[model samples]
Target: MPSMIEVRAPLEIKVDPQGGWELAFWVLDSFNYATPFRAMLIEIAEALAQHPIRSVSLPDYIVDEDFVEGTLLFNGSSLRVYYEHALSYLTLANDDRGVLTIVAQRVQSRIALI
Candidate 1:
C-alpha cells in the first residue's frame, strides 16, 4: 500500500478569477477534482459501514509519525486513488456541509469505536 493518509487539518490557497478551485485551496495541494473527491468520500463511508477498521490501540497516542502515519488498507490496497494524490487531501479540502457532516459522523464513530 502507498503510505501516508492524514485524518485532520485544513488548507489555504490564493484565488485568481482566472482559475477556480485549482488556484484556491488547491484541493489540499493535490490535483484530483471535486467530483471524484465526493465519490471517494462516499466510498470511505460505505467501506467503514461494511467492515469497520478496528483500532490498534486505546487512547491512540502516538510517539511519532510512524504510529499514525500509514496506509488505510481495504481489500489489501488503499482507496482507489484519483490522480495518485493522497486521500487525506480530500479530507482536508473544502466539502459541502452535508459531506462534512457525514465525514464528521464517520470520524466521531471511529473515535467512539476506538
Candidate 2:
C-alpha cells in the first residue's frame, strides 16, 4: 500500500470587484491555532484550491492517542479541532457547533478495528 493518497477538497473563495480574493470565513474559522499551525492550515487551503494533497499524513506507526485535540480563540469565541485519528480525520467545532470537517478518504493507517 502507498504511504498516502492525494485528496482534493473544494474550497470556498470570495472575489471582490477590485480583483482581490479572500477565503470565506468558514475556511479561516478552522485555523484558530498557533502561528505555525494556522499557517499550515492556510497552506492546505491554498493547495487544495490548486490540486489534490498527497503528502499530508503522519507516519504509519503513529497512534490515534498520540494526537491531541486543539482549541483556540476566534472572534472572541472558542474554536476547536477534534482529531478522529492522527491527521486522517478531524472535525472543526466552533462554540459548540461543528463548522467544518475533514477526512482523508484513502488513508491506509488504522485507527481501530471492529
Candidate 3:
C-alpha cells in the first residue's frame, strides 16, 4: 500500500502574474517520496499559502559580489530556504521553484505526478 500524504494550507498565498503559482504547483507535484525534500516543499507551500504576502524575517548572507536578497531559514541539516522576492520565484538551496518546475515538467513530459 502507498503511504498516506498529509496536506495543509499555509497562512498566505502570493503569486506573481508571470508564473509564480504555476511554478509553486510544479514544485509541490515533483515529490516522489515522503522524504525530507518533499516535506520541505510542503512546508514552504503551507507557509506561503498561509502567509502569502506577509514577510517573514530570516537571516542574511552575502553571495558573490552582490548580496542574495531575502529571508534565510534552515530547511534541514543540509538544505536552506533563501526566499528572495514574493510573487516571484524563490530559491531553495541550489534550485529555485521555477527551475525545479521546468526540470520536473521536462522529465515527466506529458504526465505529472503531483
Candidate 4:
C-alpha cells in the first residue's frame, strides 16, 4: 500500500499572469518516508503533456526513515518543489480527497496581429 501524508487539503492550482503554476497553500513538513505518498502531481504531469512539468521524484524503497526537510517529489525549471518532513511544521489537509483541481486561465498579454 502507498504511504499517506497530510497536506493543506483542497489542492489548488493556478496560473499567474506570466503563466507560472502554483500549488499548495500550507507547508509540507514531515512524512511517512517508508510509505510514499501518491501525490497527484505525478498523475497530473502524465495527463497534461502541454504543461511544463519536467518530472516527479518519489521516495526510494527500503528507506524506512521519516521524511525530513529537503525531500522532493516534483521537478521543473524555475519551480522549487520540496517536501519538508518535520513534525513541528505539519498540517492535516481534510478537504482535498486527493483530487487536484486545474484552473486554466487564459492570458493574452501579448497577441501578435497578422
RMSD for all candidates, in order, please: 13.5, 14.3, 14.0, 13.1
Model 2: per-residue Cα lDDT over 20-63, one tens digit each: 33222222223333213333333443333322233233333332
C-alpha lDDT of candidate 3 relative to the true structure: 0.32
Query: In model 4, where is the ten-residue run with the lowest total lDDT?
Result: 103-112
Query: What TM-score do all the candidates reach, one by one?
Result: 0.24, 0.29, 0.21, 0.32
Instruction: For residues 24-109, write the lDDT of model 3, one tens digit per residue.
Output: 22223222332233333434534433231232344333332121233323232122333322222234332345443432333232
Q: Between the candidate structures 1 and 2, which one is better when assessed by TM-score? A: 2
The order of the candidates by TM-score, greatest first, is: 4, 2, 1, 3
Model 4 lDDT per residue over 2-72, tens place: 22233444334544322344444332434534323334333334333324234444445334444322222
> How many clashing residue pairs appear in each of the predictions shown?
0, 0, 12, 6
lDDT of each: 0.30, 0.31, 0.32, 0.32
Q: Where does the lowest 10-residue lDDT sum fall in candidate 1?
A: 17-26
Quick one: how many clashes does candidate 3 have?
12
lDDT of 1 at 23: 9
